[model samples]
Target: MSDIQPRRSYVPPAVRATSEWSWRLLLIVAGVLAAAVALQTVSEIVVPLAIAVLLAAMLAPITQRLARVMPAGAAAGLTVLGTILLVSGLFTLVGTQFSNGFSDLTTQVATGIEQVRDWVRTTFRITDSQFDAYFDQIKDSVGKSGNLGDTATAVGLTATHFVAGIFIALFSLFFFLYDGPHIWGWVTGLFPRAARARVASSGAIAWEQLSAFVRATIIVALVDAVGIASGAAILKVPFAFAIGVLVFILAFIPIVGALLSGSVAVLLALVAHGPGVALIMLAVVVGVQQLEAHVLQPFLLGRAVSVHPLAVILAIAAGSILAGIVGALTAVPLAAVVNAVGKHLFAGESKGEIEQELEENADKDPLARR
Candidate 1:
């Protein structure tokens, strides 16, 4: 009876398929986690290189035009220099404005603080002793967090890291602008000969997507800056120019940037004038944001990048969690590039069909042709 053997259990096809998928899914997740760990481990180099790539994408068209007349190396250098100068000029302007107006602004803020304290005292019945006790508690909590020496050491290390990152970014940007095609070719060469063409095609799609994202973001950011700055001016808010500059810079980071800069403007108005003016300033900020969200972003960025708002939000959140402000600033563009490359690689189109579509798109967009 034992020698005859029991019949083997028959597994359903659905169960078999599930078993196959379960391990593959686990492997995929494991690979992703491994890659993330590796990236984080070398983030000092990786982050700067990533920034260079983005800067290269944004400056590529300009570099190309410059290259037509000058050498590629020279063009890249000049482009980088120009970018540095532009940023420096903006900083100088903001600094000058802030310096000129800071004293008056501080006076206004001090008076406003007194008014706010009086209101709080009257409304909440919080006495001076209670306020002092609250402040002392806050100070004690902060003191317990770390000593002055530890805090200074952290600041020094951060500054050193920042400076190193700047140099790395600049060096990489030069090479990326001057030898982008050669670098990309070398990267593809790492793959098998049969897959090199496919890799190159995907890269092209990714570059196009990145370029489009950069262009659209610039326009959207400009519109936001102008809209908010104009509102501040119309409301006669103090430091309107500073607010505009700050907003323009912050607008580079999606979603959160505009909200933060707008809040600053609102706070300034409140401190300089009163709640009445601050309320109007807030309405203006909200109106401008509505226009940006509904009109400019949808019309410009939606068409150019073709990424969903939900995806953008999620990317920003993940990036912020992973890499802080730099991560948030870069998250959308990275997502756009990945989305485009993934679609091209996995769209199931034949080689000829893909080439034909790319050709058609190139004809429409001069930048894509390159």
Candidate 2:
């Protein structure tokens, strides 16, 4: 009885492979779920910090240039002040437009409502009593739904949160622009020395991609604004410039943003002008987007942070689902950084190879050199 042979259980190759893939897939899903939960849990802090990082990335170059000719403090202060002024001016402009348009917009909306009512009455042959009953039902439903005071309180709370986030963003932005290099070095230094170069190099690549994307986006957004605004103006749309500004701001979010903002513009055109102008405005929006998709992005961005359109859409959708608009705004940049970092680690490229690749990329855009 010394040794009844122990039976060996063998997994087929396909079964083994399936088991391996199953655990890996499960691990990835679990990681994503954990990250999403963590992000949601600390959204108050993370949103502002993420926004500050983006602002710092955009303004760092200007700060650096200004620093060359002035003290770091003065340079940073100037950059921050300049950004504040620019943002203030934009808000002020939009407010003025809104104030100027509000009364007319209300009037047009009322008239549109009347027209629709008239059409419905004619089409359906509904009596005044029936329409009145409908309105009463709607009023009853509204009254039953919730209290006005509660809605007001919710709005006030949101405003308070916004103000606090703004303060956080500004406070973080100043430090980021001023001590960014030192902070980055300190961060990378925390990694083991053996892999420091690769980490640093990868970060540099991500930064380069971010800067290029930002610059290209700004340029594309401006062109989109001008093109659409000009059309709106020609079509005699109310709040034309304001619509353009909204488009410019939203354009930073890429494909879906443009479509949404453009749709708003078109709707306003329909309300303020007419169906004809609205149709023309819609065409203008589509044309400009086409130009952006084909010509501007490829030419200006130059494959630096070229995530696919489908990837962009998916990232935005996922981000919005996870963290609302802040997530949406940060999604593309996060995607670009991830893509760059992955490429930087994709092959076992040496330091020289990485530097050479970066040099070649930089050569594609003269602005990238500095």
Candidate 3:
């Protein structure tokens, strides 16, 4: 009985060697891990590349128009040079204003602190002895824990990192402008022959969407900065130009950026002028933000890369959590590109599924029969 049972079932050696599903699952896990590592590496490298691409894309249309009359190489060169000059000039102007503003702020802060102390003593009937004791404690603590050298070193390190980042970014931008198209072609070619066409098409569409988003964002940021600057100037805010530059930079962050920048403007106004002026500055910020949300965004960004506000917020939050300020700055643009691609690739399948579900529901519903 045992001998007969032993010969009953035969399993092929090939079949027993490995399970297809198990192999597939292992591959999937490996692929996921590889992708995660790749994304981390690419994010670091691609940030500057993305910035350069955005800049190039914004300039491309103008360069193309110029190419109609002049040589393409020359057109690209002229465009890049002009952009550099413009950026340098703007930064120079802002730097000058910032220096002056900082000096004035230092003086104002000293005076403001004195005035506040005097007011507190007179209004609250506080004695000078009480304030002197507080100051003495503060001085003793500060003297024991003096960190002026450490603070200066930390500032120097920050400045060094910033300069290095800027250099890398600019270098990336140069190459991006010069060889971006060729690089795109090479990248697409690396895919399988059957997939190359689709990949190329998708890449082109993504670039288009990214370019549009970048251009629109720049315009919006400029408008917001100018509006805030004008308002701050009117309110006699110290460091108006520096605050305006801050606004411009933050405006790229989407919904929350404007609020933060506006708050800074308001605070500066409050310190420099008064509460009444600060309130007026806040109103100006609100009005500008509203105009941007309703008018500028719709018109400038258009429908090409439109993403839902919820999705934008989620992306921003995720980005901030993952990579701090850089992540937050890049999140919306990444989301826009992802959204564009998702709609492009999956829209038909999603629509088909929806239709099929509806048909099945209708078949089951008594009211549909009626």
Candidate 4:
């Protein structure tokens, strides 16, 4: 008793937690900021590689199957060739149709605009002066924009960047499909010998998660596209198939993407069909999206990624802020895979157990090529 100091509660539980998490949260933010800076610094190289990785993950099962039937290199080449052809065909079809029908579409749109104007004037009792004032405001805003030459230069640069990104993605896709295992093995080899197995296991788990996420997303997208497109077709909407394709592609971007694509379809319908058809299209969009949000996504992606909705929203927001469209597209899958791998490692699962779990996952994988 003589030697012991009087016991005292110097730390309040609330204060202690606040202090403890404050520093940890700060550190996490700092680390994330540093990583973001580094990524932006090497965006050109990183963007293509990241896209290739996701595409490679999507095509991995097919690649593996094709490899068994043929040489790995030839299989990868063929897969890449097929993807290129598919994309080119889509673009060609869209461009040709757009070019051929643009003038007619423009005329129809002009007529639709007049109809809208007349309806607005009649419904709201708006005068010519009010309409002219609004139109003048729009004209003033457009007139204040940059010169045509600057716009053309900007467009040219954008097109050049697009072409370069495409080439890089394609080149990386072939190598990733053909030599991804070897590349990953080499990467793991760089780690200390004892840690290599854990690293390899974690990577395998991440890949499985990636594959599962992509495949489930693809399926859900197809379902949404079909559902919405069928409704549009029943409404006898023009370019229904094209709108379906657009919806399918945009559905990759998650919540916002599908909504925007559906809105586009609705607008087109309103212009080409009428208010009744547009209303029907609107109901179709809402119904399909609700089904996706309530049923397919939760069942499929929940099983695959196990990410909370809040986490998905946060990831998408952070990704869009960090890397715009590409980031938004990749964010959810990346977060899910990282979450899976981190949870696996942090749970102290042994490398042996990881391999077993991964094998089980692969066996049950929906997209696994039989």
- lDDT of candidate 2? 0.83
lDDT of each: 0.83, 0.83, 0.75, 0.83
Say which candidate scores most in TM-score. Answer: 1
217, model 3: CA deviation in Å?
A: 1.7
Candidate 4 lDDT: 0.83
Tens digit per residue, CA lDDT, model 4, 276-313: 56888999999999999999989887765888768878
The better-scoring model by TM-score among 1 and 3 is 1
lDDT of 1: 0.83
> Model 2, 139-164: lDDT tens per residue?
99988988899999999998998899
Per residue, candidate 3 scores C-alpha lDDT tens digits across 1-370 of 4555445687777775667767988999999678756766665555555566666767766666776798766767777788889888879988888776788887776765666667678889888999999999999998887589998998999677667666667666655555566666678779998665455555655776777787899899999999999988877788778778899989889998988899999877766655567689999999999999999999998788889999989999977866568778888988998888777666554445544543553322211211
Candidate 1 residue lDDT tens string, 190-228:
999877657767777777788777877788778878888
lDDT of 2 at 225: 94
Pairs that collide, model 3: none
lDDT of 1 at 353: 74
User: How do all models score by TM-score?
Assistant: 0.90, 0.87, 0.73, 0.87
lDDT of 3 at 167: 68
